[model samples]
Target: MGVPLLAIVAWSGTGKTTLLQQVIPLLKARGIRTGLIKHTHHRMDIDTPGKDSYLLRKAGADQVIVASDQRWALMCETPDKPLGLTELTARMDHSALDLVLVEGFKDEPVAKIALWRRGVKGEVADLLDGYVIALASDKKLAIDYPLLDINHPLSVADFIENWLRTGQ
Candidate 1:
């Protein structure tokens, strides 16, 4: 009953991030309030060394919030246990969003649009599951689910807009 979540999933080297970069602006043009959560395997840190927030966090603060007139960010230390998608989603400020787009968590059981590119080592056939509502690819394939042209961001945005309207 909160912001509906949809994932754009693909194997590494696929255009999931690139596609989302284009699609997000298009979605905003259509008045959809969107939020995003991207997952990465590499170790990442947003806090900068010598910054007050960073220094405070390094001094055993479990969480640190840096605020300004323009924006704010919360950095939480959880090295002992990584949070899963559900927990992460719950932490977002849903009051300002209509939808949340997930970049990874491909194995999670969420409704998703799978992406595939020709010669990308993995087959589009293997990406399908009951949770997949659509497939975006560089080439067309015969499939039961909706097919999307990965090269065209407008078409992808159109599909998402329609999906939002229809609650699919």
Candidate 2:
């Protein structure tokens, strides 16, 4: 079976990570194996400086793998090429996850739930443009889509579970 993917999209400071932090454990408690993908505009480093993996990459290794008994991580340096959502998701180990929750990549043409807040501009059009399947907000929004409470992660989790089950 193909891995189910959903994107959680919102403006900065809209608490996307906070909601995911709450929802991930709830999903895990239900025996759901979840995978997460976060997209950032700024540069991020998973390897620390002076570590062996870091040193190897600095010495011109294209890819570096750091493995241990507990876990393994692979870091690939792509200085010239930037990967899109499809390419990035394709690189994931799909067999290991029941669902893939994508945090950001708002323009990737995937199923998404948009977290909205009052005074946040430039995202209302996304809902109207049909890019967002559901709306989660702290304030009441009079729209024709599924509206969810941003404060209640359980309900949001329920919504996500239903979506995964029914493919709606």
Regions of candidate 2 where Cα sits further than 4 Å from its true position: 121-123, 126-128
lDDT score of model 1? 0.92
Alpha-carbon error at 68 in model 2, in Å? Answer: 0.7
Native-to-model Cα distance after best TM-score fit, residue 36 in candidate 1, in Å: 0.2
Clashing pairs in 2: none
Off by over 4 Å in 1: none
TM-score of 2: 0.94
Judge candidate 2 against the unseen true structure and give its global Cα lDDT, from 0 to 1: 0.88
> Where is the poorest 10-residue window by lDDT in model 1?
119-128
- lDDT tens readout by residue for model 1, 1-168: 878889999989998999999999999988998999999999899989898888889999999899999999988999999999999999999999989999989889988999999978787877888899999988879999889999999989999999999987
- Backbone collisions counted per model: 0, 0
Candidate 1 — which pairs collide?
none
